[model samples]
Target chain A: MNNKLKQLDEQAVQYIAVGAAVLGTGGGGDPHIGKLMALEAIRKYGPVRVLSPEELADDDLVIPLSMIGAPTVMNEKIPSVQQMAMPLDLIEKELGRKVTAIMPIEVGGGNSLVPVLAAAERGIPILDADAMGRAFPESQMVTFYLDGIDCSPITMADERGNGVLMHAIDGIWEERMARAITIQMGGSASICDYPVSGAQAKQSAIPHTLSLAYDIGKTLFESKDSKQNPIEALLEQLHGYALFQGKAVDIRRRTEGGFTKGEAVFEGTDAYRDRMMRLFFQNEFLLATEEGKSLAVTPDLISLLDQDTGMPITTENLKYGARVVAVGFPCDPKWRAPKGLDTVGPQYFGYDVPYVPIEELAGGKGEKL
Target chain B: MNNKLKQLDEQAVQYIAVGAAVLGTGGGGDPHIGKLMALEAIRKYGPVRVLSPEELADDDLVIPLSMIGAPTVMNEKIPSVQQMAMPLDLIEKELGRKVTAIMPIEVGGGNSLVPVLAAAERGIPILDADAMGRAFPESQMVTFYLDGIDCSPITMADERGNGVLMHAIDGIWEERMARAITIQMGGSASICDYPVSGAQAKQSAIPHTLSLAYDIGKTLFESKDSKQNPIEALLEQLHGYALFQGKAVDIRRRTEGGFTKGEAVFEGTDAYRDRMMRLFFQNEFLLATEEGKSLAVTPDLISLLDQDTGMPITTENLKYGARVVAVGFPCDPKWRAPKGLDTVGPQYFGYDVPYVPIEELAGGKGEKL
Candidate 1:
């Protein structure tokens, strides 16, 4: 885990933005504003060092930071670097000490980029790892949470300078209180939480996700100029497969628990003309099915891209009659554990299906209904 | 303003408990739990000194405290002294200073007693004044709020040790965020907020509310022994009038936005037979009308008592077919000011009526429907 540290440059943020969107599973948050903010911070404060988790001092204070609330709100109400840095500063003030490093609580879309601004300003390294290799709607659905890290003494802030500090007995309650605060703070807030020792970060975090996301993002970006299909490039990078290519026929959405929850129906085109695909999501795409059989379920990353443009489509942007391609990739092997399944598997998303690698579910076809 | 102080003994707690209930205007909280807790604290920590608003240094810190969320939740989930004390201690730590005094944010129901324990534990004086002489649903409906005291740096705690510190731009935002937190904290939590200087408190607080509530309670208590009607005693103390005498023929209630909001219809009895009286409320009773004319509107105190027993009936305990007498009393003279009307008048309650004194609305008969 302790390898050469990388610099969080402008070019890297661009790729990570795209990669994070893919892994975001259509939740996280809009990456456009986050990218702009991160770019400005890195430009103003110099590139932040991406430190390997194993390089952490045993006593170092490693805090996880992200935005919590409706992704739609994140898209509309832009957060400031001051807002992003507030929680970090408040945490330091509350503990009456300095935070040694910053890290993403989850790596997905805007979440992957939001913390970069803070890390840049503090002139501290950001851990090259994250709690969730991909975004999760709730804070409790993380390896760190499962490993018994109390995500309390958590601080949050809005662009208008409103702030809240929360401490709960457990991760779930923390998320509950944080969500309410976010909703009240005009729906989107910057959060700094899950304060853990460097030793704990090294043991519990999913390693090299930042580098992995950056690599995936680079591939997607380069493919656009190389005349290679971006979707195919992403599939090759993830060792995933094209699960379906269809026109979204009907989409139903409703907001619940501070999340956009809905399902999309797709009528397959091309070779799979007669096939029907259904996708269910709450903040993130958690389940995928064809006709009636379960094709993929969470812990497996399910992402949808514009059919021609290859840009990752967020849940908030999903619409009827859009031609899109859905892909499924296997998650970090650590997520295959029983407890991991309990944390974010199909059952956690209310789907009654056993975990199966996306490759196994796809069989031989790169494009399956 | 510095006159004399009273010691908060168990006997005073009992009387203040009753007084606060009458002033709670049907919304404060469960008086039983608050009385029990305040008494226990007084018994264990000894009596708290009741300070007059003027009895303070110019810079003495006066913190207002209360229980926030649904009265129903307060009834179901009783809070402990540890929970009550968490916020005050957090505030002290946040401000890096000792709070010199405790004041009720609202002198109604359990709110009047929630601060006593904090005063007892700190061995500080409890102010004999409050933000609201009678209960109002939202925090912004107080004179302190109208006077522009920022409600932030407010802290709340739950029974399970879950706590949150909120800093909002204004009192309304504070209430919005606090309401959401209260809902998540199992619908009720103890909060200590609006830390102001002694000078500010002396200028803005509704003075003598503690003694007013106490006097009302004592009058009711002594009247019970003397075979005098407690309602008449209460009215004498408030300079109010009997708005109506009737059996609660119909009661409609439903929980909304974490508050019990609805109305009750009463069919006038005896000399007022055939006339109907209607009471509208949200947490606290906000208005009363005879047929279509307004008899009372907030910032006036509206209370309902058992027709025979003379015990106050909270909105949570309201039931159909109970014979009750409704009374309306003028609020503090300060509440009749323009700012007060804007804060809690009939329009704030969605009623298309102007504020009118209960005595003026009563026409000729004290017992008129």
Candidate 2:
């Protein structure tokens, strides 16, 4: 994989949108809105420069910019460019320094692209790294938190011009305060948090996740053009497991406490017919289970793809009766550590199941037909 | 009416406590805790200097500091000195300037004295003027808001080291965001907002309120020594109307949405023995009614006083079967203006009653036996 992503143009934004959605695991807000926002920003302000973590100077200030709140609300309420950039402005003002670069807090569909708008507007580079290698529902689920980084001086802005800057003692407090503010800001807000020095970013950040997303997206697009099975091509590229191929039968979703939380039941189709899978989510898909046994649990990635087009389906976009392919990829090795498992594992989300690795659960080569 | 208040000693703190409670109008949290906190701060850090609005230079940076959230919660969860000063520290850090003086946001029981702890600790003068001459429930119900002053750069801190700084577009947004944060900070928090120039303070603040509070408290204390009825002296001093003399028969209060919201029912005594009064409050008493007719409405002040001692009683301390005298005073003339009435009026608190001047409702004399 060529990892030298230098700029985000229209084509690059498209590829990253699809690839980030795959990494998003049915969460991180609707990818369509994020893609449109990023594309519009790139078109208006010219291409945003992509900076790898290694290139950052030791003292350079890097801030992660993203959207916080229910994906359901975000789907209907699209934020303006000013709203997207307000948090960056606030954080810069609070820190009394100009930001060196903007990074996504998570490598999720919308969050991955949200930073591009601010970066382009400010004429700053966008870092090709993220705090969370893959998305999790809460703000505290970032790798920075696991590394014991201080999540203070967090900033947020809403569409109505309300701006907030918080100094939380820890990541948990940041999540609690930011989520409450998000709910008050009409269920969605653009946020800038976990501002780190270049050295801290280099030490704690999950590097090259953006490049990974771009590659994934490109693989799917090329597979489609070549008339190969796109889902199969995706599984092969990521060494992912095909958890299930099913038609969505029932979906129960509700927006509560600034999160889209619910479950969906799918009736297996094709070679996996007669089997049932229940997928649960609190923004991102947290767990996938078949007949009470775990197919994939959080800290790993579980994404739903359009069976034919190989496009990623966000939790907000998945519909009943749609045939989809569920794929599972092992998470970054860091997440397998004790602290990471305790943080985003099944039990942390109140699930009774254990977090068995996707590869182990899939019996090594999970090509279910 | 000697308004030459120079410093806050033990005696001064005692008087302001009682007098502010009277102005607080049965809200503003428990006066006892405020008095204790102020007295302790005075003992530890020496007397806090008092500054009149006229003493401020036009460019002097003045900030009002106070407590936010349900008084019910604050009565139990008393904040530490650091908690009281954290908001000041945060606001200073945000503005990149030291505060010239700290002022009380309102002339209410606990709120009126909360700034003393910070002022004394910082060795800065405490402004004798306040935005609200009498207490109102929400943060936006201030004279500064009425004068169209900006309430941006608001800061808050909880007992647990969580500090928040917000740049709200307006006062209403400040209230919404600050109140939400207050609830998240475990029901109560210390806050600093409406930081203004000394010129703004002189133009918009209710001047010499701390002195007025002291006089009110002194009158009540001296009246007992002079063998005069303290309540009668208080009514004469403030030109206040006695709304009712009754026993607290029932009170239904609940802490909800960062406010102590409820109503107190009083069974009349003495000359008005056959009547009943219902006093409704959201932090401060917004409306007082006798048999469905409005006796008083906000931005008029309605305070409950102990019948024997003539000491002011907070809404939290007004127990069942306690004999009391409910007094109504005219709010500062600023609150009589259209914008002021619109802000703290009975209708604003959803009482469905129109605001009427206390003089008109009391038949001028207001000397009901």
Docking class of 2: high
Clashes of 1: 0
Cα lDDT, model 1, residue A137: 88
* Native-to-model Cα distance after best TM-score fit, residue A165 in candidate 1, in Å: 0.3
lDDT by residue for model 1 (A1-369), tens = 123438889998898888888888898887677689899999999998988888899999998888888777778887777888889888888878888889988878788888888888889888888898888888788887878888889899988888888888898898889888888787778898889898999999988888888887888788889988888877877778788889999998877767778899999988768989999988889899986787788988899998886888888888899999998888877788887888888888788777777777878556633
Please give the distance, in angstroms, between residue B286's alpha carbon in candidate 2 and its true position after superposition: 1.5
- A235-307 in candidate 2: lDDT tens per residue? 8888899999999999999999999999999998998899999999999998999889999988899999998
For candidate 1, give the docking quality class from DockQ.
Answer: high
Interface RMSD of each: 0.8, 0.7
> Once superposed on the true structure, which residue ranges of model 2 sit more than 4 Å away at CA?
none
Worst 10 residues of 2 chain A by lDDT: A360-369
- Top candidate (lDDT): 2
lDDT of 1 by residue, B47-129 (tens): 99999887878899998888888887788887787887899888888889999999999977689999888888878889999
